[model samples]
Target: MLIGLEIKNFAIVSNLSTEWHSGMTAITGETGAGKSIAIDALSLCLGERAEASAVRPGTDKAEVSAQFDLSNLPLAHAFLEENMLNNDDNECLLRRVVCKNGRSKSYINGSPVTAAQLKELGQYLISIHGQHAHQHLLKAEHQLQLLDAYAGHHNLVNAVSQRYKQFADLQKEFKQLEQQQQQQAAQKQLLEYQVAELDEFALQADEFEQIEAEHYKLSNSQTILQVCQRELQHLYENDEQNACSILQHSAQQFTELAQYDESLASVATLLSEAAVQVEEASREVRNYTEQADLDPQRLTEVENRLSGAMDLARKHHIKPQELVGFHQTIAQELESISNNSSRLEQLEGEIEHALEDYQNASEQLSASRHQYANTLNGLISESMANLSMENGVFEIALTAQNDRAPNSLGFDNVSFLVSTNPGQPLQPLAKVASGGELSRISLAIQVIIAQKVTTPTLIFDEVDVGISGPTAAAVGKLLRQLGKSTQVICVTHLPQVASSAHQQFFVAKEIADGETFTHMLALNKDGRVNEIARLLGGDNISKTAKANAKELIKAHG
Candidate 1:
């Protein structure tokens, strides 16, 4: 519950601190007594948006802080634990500061938090039902949500939502697969022809390089052969001056000298070995010269084979060595095309199974919602009658949509209809009720669902508007009953409603030294009577009105 609130430089509230108690508390004063300003300050602590205009004159900033005792609220503790913002003291403090430059900051448990985090925590702590709450009742979506909450179908709704998301994902994947198959089919015949043509060539991995080398050798064969012939003629082709004849004469001279000295014998042996090696080399050169061939046809064939390989490489944007890998890839693609029909059939089977699962989940969800809708219509009809709508008819109209499966909520579209008079046709809630009637309807629904709501604090901002006499009394009684389980703070103008409060506060505007400010004071027993008397008689508090206020309090007591 909201235990305390502090405000400074916020609107006409320069400085104020208000302490709240359990059960129903009423804030009452004359019109424009800064009653709404107090609520606005509380709103700031509840994570409502703030602006510089909310700051009082001559102040650079405005601040609002609220303290909540979170010892009993497990949800709040869980949220704090999830955010790593847990406090050891079992209390939570929320503060907001708005600067004159239009900047605002929020803090929880003395740690700075983003505005979104503050709002999330605020939702779990307090529920403020203002004049605008009546507007929400006019929306069929809100009504549907309230009914779902009462029926306790949150888990069922989540199950349906999960299945819907799965179905959508599978549908997307199927479409992408179909598109890929279509594109692959269009290129099927072309890829087959290319693969067959490349296979027919029977290209080897190193064949291209070998053919280029052979082509170069054949092109220079004549020059190489002429050079070899000249060298062989100098070494062995000349008569008497040839290398073999010269080496033979040198060996004969060395053999004659070897008889005169021992050193000459070793020199004669080396000359003989050299002569043998030179003669062998001369014979091998003569044999190579005779066998050399310069065939133009073989050279042309080698050149044509190399050119074809190079052209294929360039056309495929690959190196000559990569032709083998290209051929392998084409073969794999051809195989895949041959087996596409089987693969497509498998995908179709999977899709059908997924659709069947989704339909089962959707049908179950729709049936549950139909049951929930009937109960919801009955509950609202009962609540409206209790709120003094004698001839009002409340209903939930469920319309089925085609093909589209259930969503997170259900497949049925729910709309709330109501008739204010017996003979009138039932229409949408927004078109049927006046502002005052809408407020009572909202209060009835809130009272009916208050047991299901887990919020620690519930604030009703003049929900008693446009009610009087016994109806006002009944509204006050209902609020008192709601306060038995939750902390309820009501801002009301009716004396009967104010008199029903377990605690009462008065908001009054004061002008001190030419400065206007607002103050809130918790009223005691006598003070409560005086405030109630004021509300009873307006600006004039008479002795007779005070007596009437006392009688009203006595009657309720």
Candidate 2:
């Protein structure tokens, strides 16, 4: 249940803080006095969308915060724990801030959260019924939702919806795969031919680089031989002043001088090493000239191989090195297309199973709807009688649709049917009921549904509109009855409703320093009587009106 509310610069309210109580608390005021301001601020705390206009005329922002006692709300407690927002054992605080630039922020237990998260948690805390809630009855989808809510079998409804979604998603995938299969035959054939050509070549990784090296060496063989012969002559093969003989003579002369000085011995050793190195180098040159091949036929074979590789690379619009990876990619694509038929068969089996699951769940949901529809009809009919529609008949029509495709709402079209007058045939709510009758019926449904709701707080913001006199009193009594098990807060202009509450709050606006402010005062007995009298007789409270207000409060008390 809601324990406290604090509002700062929100709408016409400037820093209003109040603690709430259990049971039915009536909020009453003259029109334009902002009686619904409290409810509006509470809604912001519950994560409703906020706007800049919600702030006071000159304020930078608006802030609304609410404190809830979660002692009786196990669901809300679990939600806080699950979201890591739990603090202070049995209390939960929700806050919302709206800045002048239209930016909004939400907080739970002082931890920042998204507005969506706030809404998710709000569902477990309170159920608010607005003044225009009845207008939603005209929508078919809302009618179905009401029926489902009344059934109180959320698990079953959720199962049906999930199964339908799975079946539809599978059907969509199946269609897309079928379309792809139809378009892939030609593509598969073309890829097969191209892959066969590449397969015949059988290119190996890095083989092209080795081939290019071999081709370059073979093409320049003559020039390489000339250079090698010229170097050999200069180093060793030349008969006139060859390097080997020169080095040998120089080593002998240095050996002779080594006897005089030790440094000359080192120089003789270096000359001898040079002669040996030149001799070894000449042997290597002769070995290469002997082994180097100069065949034209082998050169033609290598040239043809290199040309073939280049032609294939150009045809594929890639470098020769890239052919290997490209070949693997096309081969994989071919394999996948070849396997599509098997995959298509697998999808068919899965889709058939999904459809069976959907049918079973929807069938069970339809059965449950029928089972609860009768009970709901009886309860609503009873409530309608109490709301001054003694002859009104209410029915929940659950029409099964066998041919329609599976849908999230199951295969039943739920409608609210009513007969407002005697001897009148039952017709759809929008087609048959007048504005007044619809209001009464809406209230009846809300009352019936509220019995099954487990939320600790239920707010009714002028849901008693278009009702008066005995009907207004009846509305008040019903709300009081609801307060027995749940906290009920109603904002109304009806004196009877105000008198019916365990606590009364009178809202009135005052002007001070050229600014208007709305105040909500929790009325004591005398204050309650005066507020009720004002409601009964407007701004001028006559003696007769005060007497009547007192009598009404006494009777209800």
Candidate 3:
């Protein structure tokens, strides 16, 4: 519940701070006395849109701050905890400032917040019903929602919503599959030819590596043979000086010296090892030289094979190494195409099952709503009678349209129909109800739903607009009763309604020092009597009006 509101430099409200109470509180003033300015200021704090124009004529900015007692609201606590904005004290502060340069800033609990965040928080904190709210009731969709809310069918609604989403998702998948099937059909022949061409080569994973090694050998075969022959001659085949011959001569000399000294025996063993290594190197070189092929026909064969592999790689937009995996993918696609009819049949069956589930859920929801609609119509009609519409007929008309598919709300469209008089044809509430009647009807609905609402605060703006005398008194009594469970704030002009407030605020405009501003004060008993008397007698308050005001207050108490 809103505990306090502070508005600065906003329109005619230069600066104002008002404390709100826990029951019905009324803001009353003469026309053009800036009651709307007060409302606008409250709205700003409630995250309503604001602009520089709202700032007072010479002010640089307009600021609005509201304090809410959130000790009992778990949702508020959760939000605070989630945002890490929880305070030691259990109060929530919302503030907004609009600069003259068209910039705005918002804060929650002294922490900077976006307007959207503030708006989200505001939805849970307060609900303001101005004239525009009546228009919301006129929409058929909103009426359906309200009916559902009243019926407490949230779980059923959620189930239907989930099923609808599942159905939509399946339909999307089916459409995508159908498109894929069409595209695959168009490319079937080309894909088959490509696969066959690639398959004809019978390429293996290691074939590319093997071919590369062969290409290296065939490309430099002559150079390799020459290098190998030179190495062999130098190492072992030279007539005079060769590595193996020298090492053998050294080994004999060292063996002869080993008889004279032990160190000479070690040198002889090293020379023998060198001779063996040189002989091995020469044999390897000779074998390589004999095996190297410089034949142009062999080179041409290697080059053509390598070129074919590279060309195939380029055609498939893949590297040679990736060709193996590419073939695997195409093979899978070919298999899928061969079994396309079976796969499609499987998908169709799944879709049919999903559709059946959705249809069944929708039918169940529709039945529940239809059953609840009768009870709802009777309740609303009874509420209307209590609100002084004795002959009023209330109805929930369910129209089933073929074009309207099953939705979370069910398959039928709901419209609220009402007839204010017995002989009159029932029309949509929005089409026929005047402002006063709308106010009463809205009150009736609110009263019926008040028991179900968990929100602590309910604000009613001139809900008693077209009511007076006994009807106005009845509306006042109803608001008071509602206030027993929920905190209600009402802006009203009727004396009877004003008297019903547990706490009353009198809004009056004053002109001081060439500046005009509005002020509000909590009314004392005498003050309230005078104010209500003023409401009863207009500009002049007669002795009889004062007496009557006292009597009304006494009766209300």
List lDDT for all candidates, in order.
0.81, 0.90, 0.82
- Model 3 spans > 4 angstroms off: 180-189, 212-304, 310-357, 360-364, 399-403, 423-425, 430-435
The weakest ten consecutive residues by lDDT in model 2 span: 72-81
Task: List per-candidate RMSD values in Å.
Answer: 4.6, 4.3, 4.8
lDDT at position 397, candidate 2: 90
Q: What lDDT score goes with residue 278 in model 1?
A: 76
What tens digits encode model 1's per-residue C-alpha lDDT throughout 453-506?
788888888877877877677788888778888998999999988888889899
Error of 3 at 172 (Å): 3.3
Model 2, range 1-557, lDDT digits (tens) per residue? 89899999999999898888999999998899999999999888888888889999998999999998888777887888898888977888899999998899999999999998888989988899998988998788998888888888899999998998898898888888788888998999999998999899877888788888999999999999999899999889889978998999999999999888878999999999999999999999989998998999989988988888888899989998888888899999998987888888998999989988988898899899899889989998888888899998999898888778888888898889999889999999999988877887898898778888788899999988888998888888988999988899999989888899999888889999999999988899999999999989988999999999999889876
lDDT of 3 by residue, 1-557 (tens): 88999988888788788888787777777877865565678688777787879888888999999999996898888888898888888899999999998789999999998888887877777766674566688888888887777777788888878888887787777787777778888677777888898898778888888988998988887787888888888899999899999999999999998888878998889999999998998888888777766789977887887888889999989999888889889988887875766777777888778778877777777778888889878887887787788888889898765357656666778888899997999898877887877878877877666556667777777666677887788788888888877788888889888888788888888998888888878899999999999999988999999999999889867
What is the Cα-based TM-score of model 1? 0.81
TM-scores of all predicted structures: 0.81, 0.83, 0.80
Give the Cα RMSD of candidate 1. 4.6
Better of 1 and 3 by TM-score: 1
Best by lDDT: 2
Q: Model 2, residue 174: displacement in angstroms?
A: 4.0
Q: Pick the candidate with the highest TM-score.
A: 2
Give the lDDT of residue 442 in candidate 2. Answer: 92
